[model samples]
Target: MAQHALVTGSSHGLGAHLAARLAADGWKVTGLGRRPASETPGTPGVDHLQADLSRPETLERITDRLGEAPDLIVHNAVSYPPRPAHELSLAELEDVFRVNALVPYRLTLDLLAATPDTRFTSIVVINSESMFHADRDSGAYAASKAALRVLTGSLADACRSRNTAVATLLLGPLADPDKVAQLQRVAARRGVDEAEITRVFLRKSNPDLVIEELIDFDACYRSVQYLAGLGRAANGMLCRLDGGSAGSLI
Candidate 1:
């Protein structure tokens, strides 16, 4: 049977890259996001749906788009608004929870419950470096992702007995265009030079193995596949995409 892959947040960043890579790997790929990934400049063998994961109805929208179940599922959409502790509002915090914690969780359980079969295979959740370690100002963003990491663990526990797969990929700061834009916005807001901001970011990203960090989407896919094939069902925990270090979790 042909492999069917579903990737959320495929309009850009690692999501887009993974979608394309899965297609190249000969899977029938479908993308879910607010924007359309199929309209992307040179992407072939990928289909997309305009489903905003922040909304409660999004999973249903995705299910409607799928028409039938897919074999592989990856949740990669992240919502990172300015999460200043002193000034952030209730709405902002709730939105962060909705997107970062609740939505992915709801989708995972609902999707898995709705889709029951070993043939369905793997489910991958994307967490961030911030998910493990907390920053003073990252209350909302970090808390939600931390919860997501917990849920990834929960799924691993629940699926392990059934011989299913659950994978968690903890990311460090990404160097994609959106991350650059976010950095620029931070610089503007803080009245700092863009170069200074870049320097700070790089310094903070220094790991024991810099070259091994910033793993490509193909590598990300392989990690998930490894976990899936292990029959352990509850394996493949990536604490920091920056060098795959356990230090980040501490």
Candidate 2:
């Protein structure tokens, strides 16, 4: 039988890219997102399940949507509110945490419960570098990611007995269009080009790093593929792919 994979937040960004890549790799991919599957950018073979993860009840029908248990589960859904620590309200914090941390926790539990006899080979959590390096005006996002990171550890421990590998991909700033636009705005404010700003960021973040400055969608997809292909020996490993910028912080 072909391997099946479930990827959350598959409407766009890294999640969409991973779903398409997995489909290209011959995995039966199911993409879960708030938007309809037709609206979500995915490969021809991917199955799209529209559900709001923040509402825990929406996940109850996930197993039915997916005909079989997933061999690989990638939690890539996230809520990012660019608010400073002092400006963050309780409601905003709760909203961010609900989507980023609580939803993933509940979804994973549901998956594990529904597939008690089936062994999942890999569970990849798409974490952020914000978990370690605190970016200005992103405290809420960072805090939620930190909670998810902790949850990843707990899930790994729980799945160890079943030989289910859990890998956390600590990613840096992805070169998505939104990120590029943000960089452009910052560059405009600093009276410099975006390229120069990126260069300075890379130099200041990790001067000794030898890899590329930014993490792109391709890099994330390859990392997930590698993590999902790991043998039992590499279970419960934290794979940092932040272009070596998280050197000392991690």
Candidate 3:
């Protein structure tokens, strides 16, 4: 029987790439996202389910819809608000925490509750290096990710007896292909080079964000796959994907 995998935030970017790659590797893949796959033109072999992870009702329905327990579960959804911690509104803080930390916690618990005997083989959380390194502008985002990291560790402990390989891919900055393509289109319309556009975007957007350290989509796939494919021995592992910049001191 084919191993079934449930990947969240699969509408586009890294989630979409990972889901496609998993499907190609003969795993039965189901992708969950707020947007429908048809609108974004998702991978052919992977099944798509429309879901708003921030909504508890939607999450409950999704758990019910999942007939069989998935062998693997990938939590890749994130909510990033690039504002100072003091400037973040109550609504914004709530949103960031709900999507980044609460959703994954709720979803996993729901699955386990729905099927008491179901023991997931692997659980891969797409985390961020921001969790370790704090930024003045993106403090909320960093805090939320930090919460997720702690939650993932707690989950690892909870599932230790089940022999589930729970791991967090502590990713660095990523040059999302979807964002790049969109910028390319904008550049074409403005009759300017994409590099210039990228520079302006970096300047106006994330602070201290260097394009050089940004990992591509394929690298993320390899890291995620490596963690997911590991046996029980690799449980509670924190695999850092930063390009050796953070160093072993972390």
Pick the TM-score winner.
2
Q: Which stretches of candidate 1 lie over 4 Å from their true place?
A: 37-42, 118-120, 178-200, 205-218, 231-240, 244-250
Per-residue error (Å), model 3, residue 124: 0.6
lDDT of 1 at 10: 84
lDDT of 2: 0.80
lDDT of 1 by residue, 1-250 (tens): 6688888878877888888888888889888777754455447888877777766666566665686677678888888777475578888777778878788777777666767665546777887766545567776787888888887778777776554577877665556777678879999999998868866766565443344224456666666566545544445454346554335235
Each model's lDDT comes to 0.71, 0.80, 0.80
In model 1, the clashing pairs are none
Q: On lDDT, who's better, 1 or 3?
A: 3
Model 3, range 90-121, lDDT digits (tens) per residue?
88788889889988977887665554444556
- Give the TM-scores of the predictions, in the order they appear: 0.79, 0.86, 0.83
Which residue ranges in model 2 land beyond 4 Å of their true spot?
A: 116-118, 181-197, 201-212
The Cα error of candidate 3 at residue 115, in Å, is 4.7
What digit string (tens of lDDT, one per residue) describes model 2 on residues 1-250? 7789999999887899989999988998899888886788757878888988767577677777787778889999988775686687887778789889988877787777667544656788999877666666767787899999899889878877775777898887678878678778989999998888877767776564446456789989998988888855446788888776666645
Better of 1 and 2 by lDDT: 2
TM-score for candidate 1, please give it. Answer: 0.79
Candidate 3 regions off by >4 Å? 82-84, 114-120, 178-213, 245-248
